[model samples]
Target chain A: MQKGEAFKIEVNELALEVTSHIVNSSEIFRIVFSDTRPPLVVIESLTNGRPFWTSVPQGRQKEAEFFGKLIEEKLKK
Target chain B: MCYYNGQKVSKTEFLKLLQLEKALKDFDFLNKELSTGFDYSLNAVVRPKEGEIDFDIVQMEWGFVPAYIRNREQLGKMRLGYKDSAGKFHPPLTTLNSTAEEMLKPGKIYREAALKRRCLVLSSGFFEWRHVNPLSKKTGLPLKATINYPYHITIKEHEYFYMAGIWQPFIDTQTGETVDTFAIVTTKANPLMEQIHNSKKRMPTILPDELAYEWIFGELSEERIQQIGSYQYDYREMDACTISKEFRASLDPTAPFAYEDLPAFELSL
Candidate 1:
């Protein structure tokens, strides 16, 4: 992915901006929320499509799922 | 060893200052305004994803709670410093900073996290204290009163920067709750830090902007990691000012005393 490329998704009143990049041979997705209390969620795919998520702030697990699904759907297309 | 750190700028200001605004896009998760103080939990910036070096500023418990601990009860016990069956008192795992030497060692607690979950702990500045006592002129003995000279240190050019860190995502087996935690990585003090943190002689790994990417994404060998960990940051690049001792007595983490400065003292033998 090119530098500075990003996309946005709105779900259940929460807006998430996402950017993808490859570091150390792994694809990493950074999802930033657009809320009063914005949380940053980082997702990396391991072997067999297993996902490794980091820094999903407290009380924001549902937001993570919504952002992940959006990213997954976009990747599928 | 950095017990107190301050971020004078809000997330927006930090992003703009670092030129990370384009990569981060928004700052909703961060606190709207700057809140500074000393605490066991801190809102730190991290880059956990590999492919793109972007920022993920999140609030993490400053102390590392190992994944094995099942509940807050056990965590509390550990925090109180454990006593073995043999009745010896051992220091509790107050894991605010994991030494660079320990992070690289095989079979160590931080080894896996060091290699995989590297992060950048953002801070505007950090606090350290020097222990000082005047010597008796004729007796050549130490004086009874010892003074702790506190100093606030920051990068001269940048308003904020990153400290090297490793993080873990911990799950409570009993409650099924997940929390992400991190510990700042420390190394032998640079000349500037040694003078301030006189007792411990250690300093947090402050990574320069140019090397932050390599720290997070580069495939580093053991030798390379050592070089990066122990690299002596230029003392001239930092600005350290002696601050009022009121910071040490204040219970409020956001106390205004942190902003007060005292006359600078020359370092001596």
Candidate 2:
């Protein structure tokens, strides 16, 4: 915890560098998957202090549901 | 920076502390088992409800933000370090841990807040790094190696505890926005911490629940506040264990990791 440290994580074989930053006065986690064919952008928030996706840009909403269900669970495990 | 866990704080227990049945709706709750203070992450803290003797459990940023900081731009510049007109770079002041002794001193950043904005940082356990120097294999003598052994320290049986803290209400001058931020107050380490957080030889003022209630709710003088701010928890009533170096990436960062060559210390009485 060095004041703005980034986290490295994987989701569906995609490596992501996640950093928490203030967004609209609340903290949010964001990642950009350059490895993807179109380069995906995924953003998430914690509700009731649990992680849930809030943004999956470029029409990936349908596929994002799969990742959103358990990011927090995956983190705790 | 401090790293701590904040999971499994009994809801009923927390409500009882605040005497509130249904406050804290939509709170970030600091529910993460492991969170990094470096991220300026939100964590649960108990503070006096505005104009009320009752307490409130709320989430505030872990890093202390001085009221003089005008905006988010200044905050970023301060944390990241900014150069002046002459190209001199000013490093960020460490906000993660404020020394209790100096908080009330004149012109200190924590002075005003420490006077009127005391709080309790709720924590399950906290992480610290110990500097362990190993011997050089070729010479079989001591080597100047920077080896940091991570440890998770907690109360003997309590699932959660509180650390003395001070908060400030920061206003973004440009936008007129505001947020409450705080820093964990640190005092000289007790014997146990002397062996664990060896680098700084300091530890957070981990107050017991009784003192926690007094910290946020009791009315006291400047001397009393300073006394509580520098209060040290008994080391014998605490526990410590080395954890995986790559704990941040691990599911259970607090899980004990035994070191083969780690020197064992006789618990300081």
DockQ of each: 0.03, 0.02
**Candidate 2's error at A56, in angstroms?**
40
* lDDT (tens digit, per residue) of candidate 2 on B1-269: 11111222333333332322112232245446786798988888888886764566777988899877889999988888889999999998769889988888899999888888999887878999988888787998878877888999989866567799999888888999878899999999999999888878899998876667677767778888888889999998999999999999999999999999887774646
TM-score, chain A, candidate 1: 0.60
Candidate 1, residues A1-77: lDDT per residue as tens digits?
33467987777887777887542223456777777765554443222234433222223445455566777787687
C-alpha-based local distance difference test score of model 2: 0.72
Model 2: share of true interface contacts reproduced: 0.00
- Candidate 2: TM-score of chain A is 0.51
The per-prediction i-RMS, to one decimal, reads: 13.4, 14.3
Q: Please write out the lDDT profile of model 1 over residues B114-157, one tens digit for every residue.
A: 77787777776788877766677789787888768777787886
Task: Tell me candidate 2's TM-score on chain B.
Answer: 0.88
Write out fnat for all predictions, comma-separated.
0.00, 0.00
